[model samples]
Target: METAIKVENLCKSYGSINAVSNVNISVDRGKVYGLLGANGAGKTTTIECILGTKNFDSGTVLILGMNPQKERKVLFERVGVQFQESHYQEKITVAELCNVTQSLYKNPLDYTELLKQFGLFDKLKSPVNELSGGQKQRMFIVLALIPNPEVVFLDELTTGLDSRARRDVWKCLSNLKAKGLTILLTSHFMDEVEALCDKICILKKGTPIFYGTVGEAISCSPFEKFEDAYLWYTDEEGSENESV
Candidate 1:
């Protein structure tokens, strides 16, 4: 299988503090890969380094067989990203935002169709800041899909949604994966991880303690359930010095 993203010996630091250690991850084409970690475990830092949004102290990063930093303009055409925290003009209507995003792509998908699929069609005329939290999230997702990208980086895509809405988003993303889109996401919800992730890398203090399928993770830990195994893997008191 082709690799959509690769990171090797990735390291990042802030002065004397190590924000991320030598983390390595590879995402195959058409797979859903999750980066799991508790708060301050460097999940976001690793992703930022991989995406070329932040510089690293050492390592190699590649996306779609190209160097992200060297071919950023070309990479932008093929990669979609939805940040954990997004900001825009307070009065920018959803429709306007959608139009602007689609304009950046060479052959964009229909933003309206994407919006309708996410149940955000009626809010096109509403200002982004005025929409509810879930609506804003759906809108960001819609914008990400507008690029018709081959790979997507979603930072906590389902964070603010109710169960029904989160499941709806999952269904949509699963469909995208079926059509051969590679997704890399960070999430805290175990159900969300189990439902969408094909493989996961659980990080502890910026180092990966587990990297494999959910079943393998369950077998590695003392728990039979994926959620329990995940908790076991991430708990600081359990495996602070362990790496797998």
Candidate 2:
């Protein structure tokens, strides 16, 4: 159980509002950590802080035992990131993108095999802008995994795809974790979290309202379903704290 990521009292503010406040999070290696939060709940802000893409106003963030803010280059080598929204040059073929990303890493995985695994083999010669939304999403996912990174970040990964496509992505993600890749994902989809996550951290208004295994979160809440449990927790916080 190596600690792949750690945070203590993490805070980020946007002028008069605190997007993330005194957040403490820790993710062990080789497990899927689902960050469950609604829009504007600071889930993205917290993720950005962890990846060193955004500077926090205060507190500490460590990824792979290195300070993310100060050791970004060192941290990136072992990290794969798939942003919530991703795109590429219109004329760039999928295979070209894969090859370019592969060249950036010292030891990349087999690009062709990865593309095949994600059902993007036929789209290899297709331009990114010409592919269907699902195909494009698969392309981005393949790009992320091609580096054979130790940890991966997937933010709202299944948004535009249909049910089958989303399930395919989930299968790919599951396989990555089986290969001992630590994954941290943020999603508003409770069912997705329940199906894919080993543990979950429920956030409301820039703070952790609950942190535990998926089963634990469900068991501790007085609700019939996970979605109900989430609403119950956040609604309670909203009523009690007002600002939250």
Best candidate (score: lDDT): 1
Q: List, in order, the clash count of every candidate structure.
A: 0, 0
RMSD of each: 1.9, 2.1
Estimate, for each residue in 121-159, the C-alpha lDDT of model 1 and write its tens digit.
999899899999998988888887888999999988898
Q: Give per-model TM-scores.
A: 0.96, 0.93
Error of 2 at 2 (Å): 0.9
TM-score of 1: 0.96
Q: Which stretches of candidate 1 lie over 4 Å from their true place?
A: 240-244
TM-score of 2: 0.93
lDDT of 2 by residue, 78-170 (tens): 888888777577689988999999998888899999888888898888888888877777778788888799999888877777888888888
- Candidate 2: where are CA atoms >4 Å away? 236-244
Give the local distance difference test score of model 1.
Answer: 0.91
